[model samples]
Target chain A: MTDGILTPDQILSAAQDVLRRYGPAKATVVDVARALGVSHGSVYRHFPSKTALREAVTQRWLDQAHAELATVLASDAPAGVRLREWLGALFRSKRKRALDDPELFATYVSLVTESSQVVEGHVADLVGQIRQIVDAGLARGEFAAPDPAATARAVFDAAVRFHNPAHAAEWSRPGIEDDFTALCDLILLGLEVR
Target chain B: MTDGILTPDQILSAAQDVLRRYGPAKATVVDVARALGVSHGSVYRHFPSKTALREAVTQRWLDQAHAELATVLASDAPAGVRLREWLGALFRSKRKRALDDPELFATYVSLVTESSQVVEGHVADLVGQIRQIVDAGLARGEFAAPDPAATARAVFDAAVRFHNPAHAAEWSRPGIEDDFTALCDLILLGLEVR
Candidate 1:
């Protein structure tokens, strides 16, 4: 019950619950403290300000989004297949969050909009995963990219329609999966040629 | 001076002025008519309803956006050069709109959002142009796409952040042109491997 015993991780966990229940605009540090059965000061001790807490929550959500895809990225599969799977996993993770908990995902989207640093960090993380795949491809002689990082970014940009949150409204359209496959095939072919 | 004397093109030209001034939300059929110094009835005669008029205006904007690129599309240049020029033109057109008259570009973005049909038609036109170059590439054995239309859409989607209004906020970032070049090079490389 003491502030000394409470940890930042516990505060973050409770904050996520409060966020999901009330959404971003209505959720507050007090609300998160209430969810944790702790005093507001206790919560503030862990997070310097509400904005820092919100950014941390956004970073947490982003981390969760990439967690599954990280497995695919770390897998021993062929780099090309791993690249495709990584992208597919990324899209599925986001789509799942949107479909399974629309409110939470929407809240996360709003929070992300407010935290550009979190977004930049999240993007850097995802692109780094992509770079790993590109590096693997280069090692296997399957890709001829002169710069793996740049190639990873191009692949990311190419797949934005399928994975970018901005285009979420269009993802449910008919033939989207087919379009995703076709696009991946095209990009992979491009990578194969260097 | 009469309804019979005012052509639809004249009405649309005036409507664009109204839209640029008042934006999509406040712009009206009355405003368009006022801009042309004609009765609303004449405007209605050309466009059955306000929605129809809005759609037509959007189409007009899209047409103007593509006019120069259409020339590039119809050129006798190599398909690769045409494709690169076509994408470059499209990006330049959008960037020019965003830079020259951000208010108008923002208004057009909202108008396009409200009129999905107009957006779909515009995309189809752009993709169709892409398909033409893709088809030519296929014929010349510069591309190995089995379905030019699908590949065309892939290319269009790949370069979306540069052209799509949704990401207008990020377009102003420095090094955008370099990013565009890197992406185009990647996709072009992809398309080259039949």
Candidate 2:
């Protein structure tokens, strides 16, 4: 698209490319504008400030994964299967981002501290997905949870090593996958009807 | 304690004092000696190098906690109760160290990366303690674990947020204790023979 007709999507794509090149530190509204063949004002028009633009990039990256997870939830599989798949998908996606696109991955991770609301929303959304699966399990008499919300939170927190960015360094360890699987199995056990 | 004669414990105590005042980076044998009213050579006689001295200090800190945990394990309580108390102690000790002695905790955590063998041994030791509990539980037929070692690891990893230094910043968050107890309860459910 031409500079005059720059859409937010077009600008976001360009912003991603800029962030991928220079990371969040050196990359700025000016660079994003340069990448999109537009002035800084155009980028600012869509995102009021540099932090907003960076947050948008992070939000966009997270939304893609969210979309994929939404598909897993949309699947007609058993709640248990969906729950496992959902967590696996989250871990796999995060692992890939941390391993494959390290620059962009780091960009978003660094933003996580500054953009608390974004991070908070992302967590709440993911936990909500888990809650849905857990609530479904309880409703189907497939699981026994004294507190369904806490059950879901426990499951989410239980697998923290698999998804928490701080533990990303261990994600590549030889037995980390086995560790993830073991934790998942145990959580499933805890969630199943007792 | 004359200046000419000093025990390793005395040097270690002085080193701890020096570390508390100067942290690991600026702390040196000379500083430790000054604190102990002895020559730096006297300090070096007990510790060959700064790294060795720092490692010794960290080992001392961890050993004290290890001694406490050993007592918890020696208790005649049921394996389940022992397990709960054991994890609780680990969490509480780490939490207290991080909160009450921020400098020392930061020193240990920073040393963790460079001192992989130290960190690795610490983890192995802690995991072994958990494994002991799991083995006892299985021996009494009080817990159901297909793979006892993996069960112990899962339990440890499941509570990473409560104990991991990386999440130390969140240790002060309101309701974090409830979250810890909630996770422990879920894990206990997973462990008990069903």
Candidate 3:
């Protein structure tokens, strides 16, 4: 491999792959270095430690999620349609990633609880996007919520809770998504054109 | 202690304490026997193995939760009021039991995933109770929705999600119960009249 300068994005991509393969606990800096065919010193120069590497990987995942969500939200669709489609996409992505790679999913859930700052930052951004949508809808008399921020948080929380595979087996039978969509519809109903 | 005849309830109570203290992995038949001041043989007579004892403890916990909910529902209060009051009580109970007793909670959560029958039984009972309230409100033309069962499930899911300390922190700021009350008020708003 050429000794060309490795970009932070490349390092982040490699770190994500390692984390997806081995859990955060087992994914070491040396492992990432080995994956990149680089020296431990080279990986350390960018990440400092395993914790730093894990944080970077988590941030990268969040960044990607945000970008994907932005694309969906910005699509030329009605607010309700966009919201439902975005949630369906998000849930599907989470399900596929979790089923395809349990280790990474476990590590991400652990990080959400352990690294509050990183998780909170990501949640704040997601919540902000939801608030913006809700606010715009309310302004146009398309929704009727008194507090868009709280409603947005509730919507996000419900989506996360409903889509969790651990809870999925409990909620999702055949046509389970229908029930979830109905719930979202009711929440949106509370904010409907009045 | 006398060599008294122990009921299944007695056995479960002793096992619950042991599981809460030592966790399912560490709480063996011998440990539970010792905690109950009974012979290991006695415990073995009731539950052939540690797994059996743990299952009994979990079932007992679910039974207790169901009993509490039943009592609330059987009260003369209006359906909406009954639900809100019962849900708040349930949230407090779950938080105290689940968080304060992590070992027991871990065992319960793990057991639900491992044994779908156990989770299904509990979920069925919970859904039934929720359906009763939602149906009652709908009969009175209080709620606007046509699907009472789905609405009930959403409320149940929301309550469970809110019971998690981390998630509840989002709304349980200073005077946050007011927010929760308001949310509930909105949910049951049209479903009942003052």
TM-score of chain B of each: 0.93, 0.93, 0.76
Docking class of 1: medium
Which of candidates 2 and 3 reaches a greater TM-score?
Answer: 2
Off by over 4 Å in 3: A44-50, A163-175, B1-4, B26-53, B107-114, B163-186, B189-194
Error of 1 at A2 (Å): 4.9
**Local error of candidate 3 at A142, Å?**
1.0
Q: Candidate 1, residues A32-100: lDDT per residue as tens digits?
A: 888877899888887999999999888888888888987897799988899889989998888888878
| C-alpha local distance difference test of each model | 0.85, 0.85, 0.68
The local lDDT score (0 to 100) that residue B148 gets in candidate 2 is 88
What lDDT score is found at residue B115 in candidate 3? 62
Ranking the candidates on lDDT from highest down gives 1, 2, 3
lDDT of 3 at A84: 73
Best by lDDT: 1
Model 3's DockQ score: 0.33
Model 2 misplaced stretches (Cα beyond 4 Å): B1-5
lDDT of 1 at B146: 74
